[model samples]
Target chain A: MQKIELEISFFGAFRKYERTGPLRLTLAAGAGMAAVKAAIAEALDPAASDLLKVSALADAQQVLSSAHVFDTSAQLVLLPPVSGG
Target chain B: MSQSPDTRSIHVCVRETHLSLEKASAFVDAGENGAALLFVGRVRNHNLNKPVSGVSYDAFAPLAETVMGEICVEAQAQFGPDLRLYIEHFKGYLPIGGISVIIAVGSPHRAPAYEASRYLIEELKKRVPVWKKEHYLSGDSEWLDGTSLVENP
Candidate 1:
């Protein structure tokens, strides 16, 4: 059994937790974004689950599809629904 | 400004300081283009019926800049090739009446200029990776509701 750690950065309403710095998410090796989301849902307060369900996940370059899988540790960003003009 | 060096028709950026409408106006100025439309979005003092003191914007700068450039290209494609566009969104805390965003469009005709300007602002609101937190006069703060980027929950 192998494990991977992801550093998750937060934005928007999620910034409340961002002050603690990037959250370290642990997942099984070969896990995908769905797993990552579930892990985060478990790690944070239940109140944030509603927002998490609607948020988008990204790496350094671009947003990731739910199907995106991880083979190595990575730095990820969480984007809640955006409202900028 | 991050733009194509050769054409220089499009300029898009997310600044940590402040955005200048005058500079945006100058960037889109062209002799052949008869219409230049500039739209500046300012931070107001209230939101959701609550009085606000100021706002702080958080942005994923790299991705925001990329999406903004794509939007400028889309506007040009729909409007006309000769269009010049400028978009700048501010980062950090802004006091009431501060400038939050600016969109400038220069087109060969007034019609396209107006259409493109509207399109840029609307799309920027929905697509950019930026968020705002409103600090209230009551000493509370909250993030405003926004358009969801996820396809399915």
Candidate 2:
């Protein structure tokens, strides 16, 4: 497996941990969404883990499940549970 | 998601500007659909005994829009195909008493319009990729996560 660069976008309080914005992570090229998400959770401070795990990923169209496969796309979105009324 | 963005009889958006009730009502307004149900979400002054300064809304734009559009579609399907739906949410900082969200539905009858309007707001709260940060008067800002802060259970 080759290492590839992926950028993860965050919202809500997760933004505080990712102040640099769109955190850049290097992971196996063929990693699936769940794997990358695991890595992200492990990389973050404990306080941010639940904030990330309870979230979903997004590309340009819609929110993706953890089953999606990663590719060369540099940008990904982390959407935490919403509370809009 | 629909193949073409323009195909749906609904509107979805996530923006930094204030939401507009008139715009939402106009979009779905039709002569045949006399029932226009509008729900406006505004920022209140206090939460849990703390004076709320305001709120900042952040969203996964593409995903938020997609989910909102899908919600509108589902409401239409459940209510009636002729149901016209308009939904929007505001990003950026909204001061206390500011309008943050607008859900407008025009239907052939009042019952469907009322039911669909309620469904749109409830589902939007649960499913949309939007987050609200409450900036309290105590100089602390807190993320309103999930249904955790729902009052009265």
Candidate 3:
């Protein structure tokens, strides 16, 4: 089993949540984004999968669509769309 | 186009109507701006047919500041050397029509300043970790859901 290192940032209410971590999830070589998100949910906050919206980026610039597969190491940012003036 | 913090300028305070035009002007001067555009956000007294008595705001300060800084960096990167930007949001109680946030952008040309200022406010509202609670005269208090009030139990 190959391991992929994922760096995650939790913002807003997620930051105040107890189970948060700068999580690292290992998956098979051709793991998809969905699989990675599931792993993150299980590791960090299982309720995160329901309460928050997740977006993934590779190398900080490229936004990955939900159907996209994770090919290498990447940064995954979770955002819940908090309000500001 | 210097990245050094401007000691003379003051970031606008939360729940205040008056923006420090003086500091904003200084920021423009530091940016060597020929054109400056500022956007002020105000509180509304009503939401979805409900009367609003006032508002209370909450924020994750460290993260909010970092995100605001990132927004400034991105605006600069997109608009280049001719552009400078400032963004401030109010964090406490604000009455109807009170200024809640201010965003100012300066550029050599009018177009970039206007566009960047608008984009900054839009993106900040959508992405920042700030929440607002709305209190009504009828003893009802609810959190604002984006621009609307969400009913709470």
Candidate 4:
């Protein structure tokens, strides 16, 4: 199994949930997006996975949906829809 | 307030207690416009058949400003050289009949100014992160989902 570094941002109501560092998880190279999200949930809180509407980005652009697969060196960020005015 | 020749447009805030037509007009003049269209959105005393007293608004400032800037960029792209626009929205408590939002657009002609002004206000109401807390005269208050109310969420 290889390790992947993920950067996560929590906004709006979720900001109150985790004020500190992003959850870092190590997964196999061929892991699916769902599996990676589940790993993050396990590291954070199980309820977080349910509350979060996640969007993954490759590089600084291009929004990736859940159907995409993850590679070992891929950079990922998890952000929930910010509920604001 | 000072003027800059390089800045043909401006955005400013007026206290709820004191709104000035002069300052707002200056922004339009600064843009060297032949026509200016301004939209003032006020708080009504009643809403949806219910009595209303006041309202409060809150926002994530950085994100809100970024979003507003994006709107301006989009307006520029859509309207091209014919339009210059300014938008101002009040946060915190606003009493009945108080102006809550202001949008001003300037153009060489009234058509683009009017069209852009309408577009700016509609898009801002749809996209901006300024949430309102509606207060009723019956002693109840509720936080309104701004985007949701505009059918953009």
Model 1 bad stretches (over 4 Å): B1-7
Ranking by TM-score: 1, 2, 4, 3
Among residues 3 or more apart in sequence or in different chains, the pairs in candidate 3 whose N, CA or C atoms overlap within 3 Å are B14-B90
lDDT of 4 by residue, B36-104 (tens): 877888888987899999977654454455556566666766775546667767766878887777778
- RMSD after CA superposition, every candidate: 2.6, 3.7, 7.6, 7.3
- Which CAPRI quality tier does the interface of model 1 achieve? medium
Cα lDDT over the full model 4: 0.59
Interface RMSD of 4: 6.7
lDDT of 1 by residue, A1-85 (tens): 6888899998889988776799998788899777889998888889999999999998756778888888888998999999897
Question: Which 10 successive residues of model 2 chain B have the least lDDT summed?
Answer: B144-153
Give interface RMSD (Å), model 2: 5.5
Tell me the tens digit of each residue's lDDT in model 1 across B45-125: 877799999999999998888888888888888888789999999999999999999999888899999999999999999
Candidate 3 residues lying further than 4 Å off, grouped into runs, are: A1-80, B1-19, B147-153
* lDDT tens per residue, model 2, B40-133: 9999999888899999988777777887888887887789989988888998899989999999989989999999999999999987878899
If scored against the real structure, what TM-score would every candidate get? 0.92, 0.89, 0.59, 0.61
Clashing residue pairs in all predictions, respectively, total: 0, 0, 1, 1
- Local accuracy of candidate 4 as per-residue lDDT tens digits, A29-64: 777767876776677665665444342333323335
